[model samples]
Target chain A: MSILIDRNSKVLVQGITGRQGGFHARLMMEYGTNVVGGVTPGKGGEWFDGKPVFDTMRAAVKTKYADVSLVTVPARFAADAIMEAADAGIKLVICLTEHIPVADMMRVLAFCRQRGTRLIGPNCPGVMTPGEAKVGIIPAMVALPGDVGVVSKSGTLTYEVGFAMKNRGIGNSTIVGIGGDPVIGTTFVDILEMFENDPDTKKVALLGEIGGSAEIAAADYIKTSMTKPVAAFIAGRSAPPGKRMGHAGAIVDGGEGSADEKIQALEAAGARVAANPEEIPDLLS
Target chain B: MKLHEYQSKALFQEYGIPIPQGRVAETSREAGAIAAELGGTVVVKAQVHVGGRGKAGGVKVARDAAAAERHAQAILGMNIKGLTVEKVLIDEAADIQQEIYLAITNDRSAGQPLLMTSMQGGMDIEELNRTRPDAIIREHIDPILGLQPYQMTYIASAMRLPRAHWRSFLKILSGLYACYNKSDAELAEINPLVITGAGALLAVDGKVIIDDNALYRQPALTAQRDSSDEPESERLAREAGITYIKLEGQIGCMVNGAGLAMTTMDMTKLYGEAHGIGPANFLDIGGGATPEQVATALSIILSDANVKAVLFNIFGGITRCDEVARGILTAYNAVQPEVPMVIRLQGTNAAEGKKIISEAQLPHLISAETLTEAAQRAVAAVQESA
Candidate 1:
């Protein structure tokens, strides 16, 4: 069994009428995800890809009984969409929209915590369980079904690592992009717990970048909690200090978030740290 | 997204936080005039985004108007940490009885906004937290409940603030919170929240870093952006809806996603360092960018003369590979780039993209099957060209 999602999990696509939402919703269905329903505020009663669209998440979940939701709304309305999904009882929500205001994310995060609903990303590529279900925007061709579970903060980096693993005949159990925003829904520790519990997952590969204490926290968790062998890659090792490396969260600030510091912490915690993506397969082996 | 000290103070003043009367001046004569209006005893502080302006000699106390002119003249044209000082804030000097530190910033680990206050003020808070952690008091604010009065009082008492200054301090705290929330600021800080000899609490220095994500909704705050401090390419990239950061190297990278772009840069650096070449710049065309946007990104990369070879790493998710290929061809024809290029396309419609590239068979272009191969080829190409 894969972590977070599987073959039987029904998914709801929030903001399904929008360009990105519609496109990815179709892709998810093509990848064997159980696309159950769609939700749009003003476009109710419309059918997208044989799924009924509802104006509100409550009505859609009530009729379709979805267990998970893919939020594809714009950044301005993403927080409300997430809160609606949580209130409608979707246990797991994956947000694909990026650039969500930090304050809006703080409120939504607190709300999701109170309701015990798991949120993946507000600026992420989403999650995928290979050979079962795919949610969010990760290209399905890059990932193959296997025993290694992957978690990362960057979307393309996940693809790069997954492609490398695939080239080495190392398929993945599940892959999660927790997003590269300063404030994200899920942490490395959260995904690590799931990977450790999944019996199909024999090992994990965590792809991290220079920012935040999430990797350090994950290292601490791996040191104390897990028995699975983990190989990790931290990007932006040579990035200049005080410069943002594309991602909003990928910045070295106050000497706190740096590749050297993250590498040191991960190494001390018994995790093999790969210097480059090409080395991840060997480290895991 | 970082506002100048003067801009931060303007927002603070709007929120009822007391600030020393200040005027921004682009000229030394204007600074002297402002200092004369403020009774001749003024502080000439350079306006730049980088920290440690005081250490950089960007800040000075002018005892008279003539001194103010000299100080402004010296600080205005100076470069502090690669950012040139274009303007200076001339403000009335305060008679400080004591200094305090107060700021509101996001605590990413807690997924909440943290309000931090310290008795030790006018110093680097990070340094203070490192050396004297006990001197700071932190309170996590509930986004819904906000900064409660009791929470403010608790922090004030924890910092051992005098009872006489508690009310005004609370007002400043609330005002700062309002500014942070209303402005969509990632950080709203008053480094030295000073208590004057007249027993008045004032925000002596202020800093506000607005969240770039929220800039779309904040038109007024976005208008405060000083693009002069950024590189010309960065400013142009922002206008073109791409993310670009110029670096010191020979291989220019154009990638689809931020994470992938950084990884590409890292890989380029790793392989290029061995070959005595490194990534020249960081450019992300972002998700679902059009062919024209890709063309624009390529032009930006080529605009830098230091680049000897261009590396294109595209993993199509929302970004279609064929579109990126078309954009590359468009840029190749338009810019007539003399430098060599190594391209790697994968995922959505990658075969179609590869067919497009092979069909064109542009001169000096090398196609690779993977990121590692592409980086290696680009590094080798740059070294060969050099």
Candidate 2:
């Protein structure tokens, strides 16, 4: 079975009445995600997409039995929303809101950890288990049901790799976007562990960008713990030092985090590092 | 968002961390007046975001007011690591007995705020860490628990700080941590936290990088943003809601998504390697971008004179290809860029987007179905033009 989300997962959409929340919630529903209800603080007792709206996550969780939550609140309130979701007993918290303060996220992670909740992404595309459920912003068209589990720190790049894999007639078991934030809820090793345990997943594709030692840690983990064959592609190889390449986390600092270092680490760990995004599927095959 | 030394010192003062008495000066005459006010013996430090200001001669010690003016005059317009020194901080020079390093930064791996201190101060911490790792003492502060008093004491004792200075050192540590926490700073550093000849602990140099994500709440710090040190194009891109970074190559790239934008830049560089051409800039139009934003992004790319050719790689998910096409057409009509352009539109409504561009039949516009083809074409066009 696919990891994280499946057809049976009851999802609650936080900030479901907002523009981004409403837009992506509809897309998630269209892809057959088991979205039970919506949560908007003041807009409670309203209805969105024929689902009941609640003021608090506790009400949403209690009334609708929502096991998972997709937080689409604005950056200012995102950390609080995540903490609320965890405190309200949502097992899997998926935050789509980006740019929450680093300190706020650190506290949120601590809060979530104490509550035994698994949080994924504050700036991530969310997760998609092909042919089962769609939880976040990952497009439904690009994914096909199969065995290659995909995890990335990027959105469109994951879509590109997924589309290539789909074209190569190799579908995905699950796709998790852990986000490219300097501080995120989850890490590469966290998702890789799930992919390894999932029987439906035979191989994994990891899409990484420059910045952070997570890739190096992942490489170490892959070398020691992972048994499944993993193919990886890292972006920002051509990026210059000390420049942030769009993503907040994608920056080279003191020559620590570079694509070359990551690629070398992954290669040394027995993982095939693809030259580009399109070569990912070929590497996996 | 990196705050200049003077700015960081101002913030440090607010938090009760002692800094050398100083005032920012834009003119050499102002610097002279400030130095005279501070009893003539002053340090003129250039205000710029880049590091190694000391090595660049952006920092100078003046024995008198006249020397302060000369130093400020030499520094104000001087280029330090590609950044111009527009202002200098004139401060009363400190009599250093010893130097210490202290900082509070986010430890991404631990998911906590990391407090680092070293006796080997006034030097590159990274270089020090690489060379003598044990010389640096680190403490992880729980976001909820914060920097405990014991943690600070442990660090002070570990560094063999004198018992007499421990009390003041602890205050400085707590003050710095408080400033870091309250300001939502990614990094709050006091490099060379000097013990003065008078036995007073003072923050001789300060650096604070406010978390950009938290800037919404920090209106004061946001107002202090010095655009002079950064490229004008970057500032424009930020205002336009585009994430842009200027490069030294010729192929300008506009793509949706940060990862894809970087990859597009890499691919462009890879293909252009043989031709000695590469991406001139990294521009991410971002997801769900409107036509106006896309047009603005295009304008920013075109604004870079080094750009010989422009590449548009849009893999539409939340960002629709049709919207991108409309924006392209809008920019094409508005800017009338003379550079050859290549467009690759895939994912949602790719065909519709391609059809829209082809139907427009804009002059010097080319299309590719794949990223590889688009990069190849973009590089080839730049090479051909060169």
Candidate 3:
């Protein structure tokens, strides 16, 4: 009853030869994710943890069908990586790379949108359908299959919220990390709409920080499109004005992008606000 | 990664856009010598990372070399919004026939570069965009083919640039876009892209923000960065491989996780409002930072003169709270800021962790029962400081 994935979904690892790709692939495989095949440019007929490796994604697609593709390549090459996966008939693509140039992401998003591919993050933590497919870098030690659907832009906080939820015997249907890149492929509204439509997901835990109109846009969606209980925790209430860290889009400008401003907007939309990370689990419950 | 006007103009010139003849001077003597060499009325602008300098007494019109020297002396050592200036940009004053604004940046919603243009320039364009939305001409450019001739023409027409001047406008736009792509700029802006009385379309003021990630590839640009423009603490953090952003609040934040950092700040405000306290800054030492790094992170937060109290929220998984506590103690020994600190230790080894902090016998440091209590304690401490 997970949102983006379930037990039947098979996953493919792109750029599997790289360090981050290899590391996360093993983690997903260890977590019992149905990691079907690995793709590298020239390293074919190789074996990583008893899985077949192919030179190109096309070859990998022909031999093994992957419902989701995790793109772990560098920023400059992320666009081509996603396009290759989409052309090969992969339905979902989770971009794990950070600092993907904004312009490159636009072209990739355009290419994927035409093909009807669901892109999770160009800077996001990949999706995790708990107790099923853990395709992202979320600490699976804390996740359990439950009714709460947690989505966040911050990586480590996602783990914390998941830990808090698990601590309270509240498992999660799925958790999505919408990376904090300014020009990410997916937004809060997109995931909220997805979580809203998933009947297994009884509640949505939204984690946002100071930056952009994403929070505002999410509030607009919740007010109109979504019909589920959304418990949101807007972080960076004490964010320094007009400074950006890690994420390019994650900056405050002209005092407009503050955590309080976001929380107020979310509260106006009828969502319960978790003032602290610990309060998130109880709010979701 | 904001570029000063003079630096931005350097990039604009590389893109073939025309700019007022200018040189950057660090000393009043240099300012006078450069102004005298240019032999005209000059604009002396304080070189700081912040905006609103024009109103902050950071920018001034100098009638001649002597005035330029006087203005430079006033600006170079002046403090604009906590950023002390060390350089002044001396430029030939423009004739300004017509002024317009143009900029390009990432629009997260459209997942593309948003080209913003307006006929209204030299002031807060936000006001105009809010009041008269139609006044701001915007287009989402396709990244693959880059900016097209037709799109530039559309913007040129929207700004009501004389039909005879469309060619120059098109050239500037192309160069700007090229500069944006080639230079790996996150933002390339020419506010008041002026048309001189001599009928020349020029980028009088330029701002190019190079993407920090791309700095490895752009060595020439990497060298051009003025670290003096950044806050002393921010530069120190950069050198330490920590991402620290200074904020104006009362409660100082020190958290191990970026996500936890945000939640700590959010909760502090929630609790602060409940108890009439506010946060002074947001600090994320990052998960897996050594105890020493944790202590260093604390010192940075305490370095802010505005901070009244410190909030430590460490979620132990990849980061152990006991290690973070040790860092706090180590940092306390090093910086020794006479401020209150409240820490909530959770995840791996939570109890053994709380005992460690208590055993340290540190003054003004409180051990909390939970994250809520910790945030409340921090806010109360800050309010007490007030």
Candidate 4:
């Protein structure tokens, strides 16, 4: 009943020959993701982890019948790989590569939108439907199958909160890392709608950071549309304005995108906002 | 990645956008020479990154070359909003008939590039948006189709700009968009696009902030980065592939991810409230960080004299916990840190990581099982030291 993915999903690994792509591909496969094939432009007609490799996504898609793609190509080539996946008729593409140029992402989002393909991230840990299938870089150890849906902008915090919650006997239906880039393919509101409709998701945990009005928009959506109980945590309370705190999108610019603004908004929306990630499990409970 | 006025103007000129004839000078003599060459009353504007330079007296109009030199002397080396003015732009002053604000930037909410303009210029756009919302006109450009001729005309007409000036206005607006797109800029702005006494449009001031991610492709713009504008520690952190921002607290923080690092800071602040202390710095070693980078991050944090304790919160995903523990030991040997330290390692080989730290037997090192415990311990260490 997990949203976005399950054990039945057929996944293709783009840039499967690269270091990160290769490593995470094995992890995803080990976690029971139906990774059918791999794609590397020049190194086609090869085999990686017992899966067939092809030169182009179009060829791989035709042969493998993969509906999903995990793009772990280098930052410079990631956008092109995403467009390639969309062009090949992949319904969903998750890009875990970080530091992609925002301009490239703007074009990629437009291209994907035109093709009706849902792109997840350019600088994010990918999605995980725990105990069913996992994509991207979320560690298998932390993911446990249950009813709470988790979405976050940060990869490690997602792991931290999910791991802690799992230890407290609260497992997750799905965990989505939408990335911490100024321009991302999916937004918190987008995932919130899906989580609300999923019958398996009884509650949701949102992890947001400083930057963008995504949290504010999420709060608006939560107040008006979401019926599920939601607990949230907004990071970077101590961050100063105009400083990029690690993530390119995690900057408090011109007095906007502060943690206080986001926390206040979420609390006003009837969702409990945690002062720390450690408090989120109790709030969700 | 914010370009100075002179740099933005240079880029504007390259894109066929008209800019006042000007050059940047580091010395007053050079400024006077540029002023004289322009052959009219000139304005000496201090080149610094912060806004409100006009209010700070960083801007002055000189009626003559000598006056320009004097103004340059006063403006140069002056401090504006914590940034030192090292250069000045000497340009011919325009006879303004009207001021218009225009800019092109990414609209994250709309997921498109936005063009915002106002007839009321020489004021902050946010202020204008608040005080006179109707005065601002905006259009979202499709990233694929880009800024079309019709959209340009629509905006110009909406502004009620005279038909006589539409052609020039369209050129400048489209040129600015082209610069914005080609440069991969997050923002390209011409504040107070003036209608001169001659009935010609001129860009009085310009600003461009290139996306930091896109800087890899923009080598020329990357070279234009002003290193003097940042602190030495920040510069070192950037070079080490770590994200570090200095703060005025006592606990030095090193975490794996940006969100976790920020959360760690928040946690320290929340718990440190009792001890009257907080995180002294925000440092993310980034995913897949090597022991060398961790050691480097530690050195950078320890270098901050304000730091009384250090907190390491590493949740291993792509980043391994054992490697970080080894890095901590390596840094401990190198820096001989006297301040107490709290380390929390979880997920992805947490057992091996804990074993490494225990075997290192480093002095002043404490272990915590959870983020809450780590933050409390870090603050307690700071309090004990104090």
Residue-level lDDT of model 2, residues A1-285, one tens digit each, is 899999999999999999999999999999999999999999889999899999999888888998999999999898989999999999899998878888999999999999999999989999999998999999998889999999999999999889988888999999999998999999999999999899999999999999989999999999999999999989998899988887789988888899999999999999999877888877887
lDDT, candidate 4, at B212 = 90
The residue-by-residue lDDT of candidate 1 on B25-103, one tens digit each, is: 9999999999998885899999999999999999999999999999999998999988889999999999999999999
Q: Comparing candidate 1 with candidate 4, which one achieves the higher DockQ?
A: 4
| Candidate order by decreasing DockQ | 4, 2, 1, 3
The candidate scoring highest on DockQ is 4
Candidates, DockQ: 0.74, 0.82, 0.55, 0.83
Each candidate's root-mean-square deviation in Å? 1.5, 1.2, 3.1, 1.3
DockQ agreement of candidate 1 with the native complex: 0.74
TM-score of each: 0.98, 0.98, 0.90, 0.98
The CA lDDT of each predicted structure is: 0.91, 0.91, 0.82, 0.91
Score candidate 4 by lDDT.
0.91
Query: Which residue runs does candidate 3 get wrong by more than 4 Å?
Result: A15-23, A40-43, A73-80, B248-252, B272-280, B298-310, B318-342, B348-366, B379-386
Scored by TM against the true chain B, the candidates give: 0.96, 0.97, 0.87, 0.96
Model 4 over residues B33-53: C-alpha lDDT tens digits?
A: 999999889999999998899
Model 4 docking category? high
